[model samples]
Target: MAHWFHRNPLKATAPVSFNYYGVAGSPAANKICNDLRTTRARLLDMFTDITCTPEVMKNATDAYFSLLQSFIVSPDGSTQDNKMRFIQNFKWTDTLQGNAPRHVAQQDMVFELVSMAFNVALWYTKFASRLAGKENITEPEAKDVHRSLKVAAGIFMNLKEMHIPRLITPAEKGRDLEPRVMDTYIIQCQAEAQEVTIARAIELKHKATLIAALAYETANFYQKADHTLNTLEPECSSKWRKYLQLKQHFYMAYAYCYHGQTLLAGDKCGEAIRSLQEAEKCYARAESLCKEYRQTKGPGSTAKPSEQLFFIKLGGLIKNTLEKCQRENGFIYFHKVPAEPPTLELKASYGLAEPVPFELPSLSEQCTPEVYATFDLTRGAKNDKAKPKEEEVKPVKEPDLKPQKDTGCSIS
Candidate 1:
């Protein structure tokens, strides 16, 4: 499963000393700054170990952000005037655009919030990948894999919708915080989550028609995710795009191969043969992409997807089923094959994945009024003067694929 998802490394950041000197403030602010520095360091370190429990990461995240809230806004909902007073420079590297560090010096803490959240989302994806890489995942591990992806998707959406808009400075083009990058992350997480559902359905021996529909929908997700990156530099995105393209083609083959099985069950031998032929074509395209994926330079672990058991199984299944369909058609009904492949089922009534709803935790108890009052709120930061208006990030719109007839058993 590590090989299944293309993950960029977690965004890197320079250490924040959080030193406040010569400024008039309560002594608690100093303790708060120290807490901020230590807690953030712990959270960043946790990401280095994919095996770190989510509970630990969540605790560290809460500890840091609780203290951080005082810097952004007060409990009264008024934007803090001293937001830009924190002299510590927060530097973060863009996950996709390039490796160079981008720094925000006393501009706004919202930038820090957005950058950290992005890294946290990346951690969730890496955690999911670690769970999936297990040689023999138990049922619980499978569900964890699915749940982790949904959480990651939710985090990405949360940042896009809530935090990025609050930044005093807009994210630069090709940066990780850019809307296009966020959209790609959201869609890819969702598609990968649904992949788990498809695998579960197959293990449960659900109906071929149902599985085909789910696979078809999953392929569309991968295609959509890839399309979001189409305008980016080829060298920067080609490797990641190749993964998406391969998954798209591979799932299309999965859909057609399973649809062929369903058609055979219905005694429609000619349509079955056509469906299998389509499956063969898609599988061939995916195979080529697999080769290309291997050769392409990229960040993250190199995966030989073609060598995976899942890939091997699908190739075998398509070959076997196509032969069976052709053999039965010749020996028995001798039905004429359709010139075009039959329409695949588009609406799956069962086993589609959705992102888990997510919201940032409320400001921590450490952000008391006494602490909030320590920072001067009289003068606006220089950066806040005549800020340029930026385009609002549009919410991601998803089509409502209403469930059709239940062609197979449903998962409760």
Candidate 2:
């Protein structure tokens, strides 16, 4: 009986014919027939292993078939009415006749079939949403859905890739090719699966770094923009400090990119690209840095990004500053006066006994022996004539020079 049922159940059943005015060999017929056949086969296989009473098996089979047929006819690809009809008519649990193994298998098969059908219905809803021009989903929602799908796909793909020794696994040893069918099923599941978190993590890490770098670069660029707008020296250190702050932030941004790139290289190509791209943005900020420095100093005082050496070295800073000044003001030239040493001049007082005649050197005559002799001879002659004559000295013999005594006291 089991052999007969397995071989030709349809032939054993009573046949009924109904005439319908429909195209027998049209594209629509082919499409519909294929869908119907596939759906029927899936449901039949799901129930085939059940060890149930004949009536229970018949009712369950008829219920599944009717539901599939209704789905085919429904414009939306799913109908609540069809689901309700299946639920009302199909008593799947009753079909298993106290056979634990068969009951569990049958239940699992039914659950799988129902889930597949539900997925189809959901897909139709998504299609409807897209058709209505309402596909502008939020980022969070999209990310959530994408993440879910990726995870599902990754798991299924992993399962499909699993290899087993044929002798060790029961399914592998079976000649019925159930293992091969299971592998195919896993592959199909993988095809519709979502991406994995590890992959996403790698991708997002790089993206985040890129965004941060972009922000830092943008802020740095804007901070320096004021340099071009102002002409005078910055009154306070605020602008300079701001410029330095920008540079510091930009450095940090680059650091983030570098770190992110390292992390991404492991398994995150997407993230690595993002981080590197951000680093590029930081490099572009050089222009803005120059502009800001020039604004505070002068148009010619613009500093290069690579000119950090000047800030660190004393002489370099002075030289660069001078060079910048010269460039802005054209050639720099100055006439400096030589400093003189201190000296003293001599002058005679008018209270002197002899009128001292100032002797000055003759400008035309050169100092020689004849000039010195003439001046000395004239001076000596004058001194000799003016010599005072000493008269005969009258010598008076002083008798006695008496000592005078004090009036108050007698001479003691």
Q: TM-score per candidate, in order?
A: 0.88, 0.18
CA shift of 113, model 2, Å: 87
Q: Which ten residues in a row have the lowest lDDT in candidate 2?
A: 1-10
Candidate 1 global TM-score: 0.88
Tens digit of per-residue lDDT, candidate 1, span 273-304: 99999999999999999999989876545555
Q: Which candidate achieves the best TM-score against the true structure? A: 1
Which runs of model 1 end up more than 4 angstroms from their true locations? 79-88, 97-106, 377-412
Model 2 per-residue lDDT tens digits across residues 295-365: 55311112233333211231232234334333433433221211321111112121111111211112112
Over the full model, what C-alpha lDDT does candidate 1 score relative to the true structure? 0.77
